[model samples]
Target: MTEILLIIPPFCYGDLSEAGPVYPSMGIVCVAATLEHAGYKVKIIDMFAEGYEESKLKSCLEDPELKIVGVSSVSATFKISLNILKYAKEKRPDTTTIIGGPHITILPDETMKETYIDYGVLGEGDNTAVELADLIIKNKGSPENIKGLCFRKDRTLIKTEKRQFIENLDELPFPAYHLLPMDKYRSYGVYDSGRKTTSMITSRGCPFKCIYCCSSELFGGRWRPMSAEKTIEFIKKLYDEYGIRHIYFQDDEFTVSHERAMKICDWIIDKKIGLTWECLTRVSHVDNELLSKMAKAGCKSILYGIETGYEEGLKQIKKGITLEQAKNAVRLTKKNGMIAKVSFILGFPWESKEEINKTIDFAIKLDADYSFFTILCPFPTTEVYEQIAKEGLFVPEFNMEMYSAMPAADSLIRTKYLTSEEIVQMMGHAYKRLYFRPKYLLKRMLSLRHFSELKRNFKAGLSVLRFTVKSMGKKAKLAKTT
Candidate 1:
């Protein structure tokens, strides 16, 4: 029986994504680590990895010593998260229910209206989580003094002062990975080497203003990063303790600090940790020299968000990279013996069919080892979402279930010029043309070494075929209607 319980609600994508796309909830784990360092007992239940067994969940809720229940969620998964919190509130009305993450951080007032949620931590919850847990433990002190918190006062919503970002990330303890079901977590789609794999975040936030991105809102507009020494130490621990060979950095922009990245790579080489890693970053932040150093440090892959190929779409999104820059970045990544994984979006509300086609052609010309074609989703709290909502471009009764950029046929925001059906067809066509080529198939086959690699690749290939066939069927009906 612990004083606090941290829960991640199980979710289903409903044709949008795999039924259970499990990964460690780094947010909650970091909070748990803070609580542990502060001398508090904490328990975590990752419903996403554990399959959300009702009996097991009920057993966790039955702990008579439980004082606080914390739930973390993103924008799309907030509804499921709310439902789970509501259930917990019903079971133990006396226990305090707290919610945090991207959703609540973006719309604190709206989220606080949910009575089941007794409190919410606005952003970067490590410190605020400890504050809340301390309050519950002491059973004293008003929440009004706690910064970055939202709670009820006399049946009215009250928000506190904004919390400052942690300047030195080294001050925080390593994430409580021991509390997670490490064996059950897997992130496979488009991840070529997915055995004994886990994800890490070396830094937070981005300075660029890409309209479709919500990184700035979630991590604050400023870019704060952990020191190179701390990041390398964290990597060594993961490799030595968890036997994790492949690490995927989920930072908004890993290469934002070129000097820091270079130092980290050099340290990885000096220590000979023997772990291959991948990162996602803007094409503009990297150069040939950086790629060379990263390759020397066992960087096998680099994912670039080349959002669009057409200049007009690029301008609209403020991607800050020209077509030439993107091409050079991919070229450098491959030249340095790393796999270049590129991503593109098919539907911007202001984009035309001709422009979308040009973007698709550009992806083929780039000929990356892996490509992800997402239908542009105007997620809430994004520049694109605000623009689309103002222009009434979103589909009538648009639901969050289709908010995923994956699910080639799920289009919730359709431009006034193009119907939602057309966007879906275009997304499906992009994936089929990008992945089903003879050269692409041969390239992927040559890279395969183990059964796990073959299984993940085959599953991804089959997924592409299914999305294509479904969209093709929808296209015939759409053509008849026109």
Candidate 2:
């Protein structure tokens, strides 16, 4: 008989920047399902989709029966979450407010220090959230005993032991899509591939130990995937119910298991579900045969993190990929008639100017249908973060909010080898070099097979241009002040 509300805070980006359209937050959906299954009446307010202002958020929080309010956050949206929590307190001072997600998982103690948040649930929240809700309803549970949670006791922060990683991802129920406000979300494929889009995750966690990545710290070192049958069932339901033709597999690495991935693809083909999808993959996991099979099964595109062009720089970042593998992946994707998108990072601590140019050259050589470049960010809880901290290289004032808005260029934790300005310059150079080539422009123009593809590409290019100009202006203004 208890009522609960799950809120996803609004994200920034006044204008759609170079980054593509925003996807719905799946984490909240998962938590909502878990709570509902436990017999709690749950309502989800997705601010990103609904475009709610402070007044609207306050109205939702004003309910006297709202026993618990669960909010989700990431490093990019940490401040927004904090603001929502503060507003919740203003409306109902006694409400039990809980904060969970990536940011909280990494800095549980620091998050618990904020008086607005009653508890922080670290790691996967499906199980922990249900348990917390039950405890609040029964009035017999102590927050201190909850694993993967942090709370304050007698004005001191208390973090319980970390929760063990979920072993069988299949056990978690399908995300409560029915509970979400589906119409509020806009759907479009990444490259305008004529498919209305949705996002899915067949797996949790990544086994790779990339220094610049925080997935391992948050999801643990092991990879866990849902069974192929369960994965296909979700896809079938998505197609039949939502009329969703496009799916973005938001997995950290979708191709980690060869047999499992092939089996999933086989199921899709066998069922003739006709769903077009995209996913992030490692170069080493893919080859011509697998890519061909996936393309035949309705894979429109594949994104690979070819972090660097130079082998040494790749090694420096612990990307676990070779230049040959990256090149072959691109070639294979193209050969299989699928759009290949390669993502690159500029300004590793050990990278030199020559290495930066090599990365640019490599991206140009691959000539993937789409390419993305970002500056190296040493987010907290990663090996890169620890290394920068040990060497006194991290910007002391850097917090979650600043970390998110820090231009992909200026975001780099300043290294002993590369100045922040140098990194910013490299990011600009990488984009300009990869995108402005005459041959590349011609190829893109010729490859436009439909009006939607042309329009999406043009808009995406303009967004990148706007972002670059804005980033440059900010840099120039900062320099003048200094």
Best by lDDT: 1
Q: TM-score of every model? A: 0.93, 0.92
Q: Which parts of model 1 are misplaced by more than 4 Å? A: 11-22, 187-195, 399-409, 475-482
Once model 1 is optimally superposed onto the true structure by TM-score, how far is the C-alpha of residue 44 displaced, in angstroms? 1.6
Candidate 2: segments with Cα more than 4 A from true spot? 13-18, 184-194, 399-401, 406-409, 472-482
> lDDT tens string, model 2, 85-128?
88887788878899999888887766777898988999999889
lDDT by residue (tens digit), candidate 1, 24-105: 7788888999999998889998987877777876788899999888899886667778888898899999999999988788
Model 1 clash pairs are: none
Model 1 TM-score?
A: 0.93
How many clashes does each candidate structure show, in the order listed? 0, 0
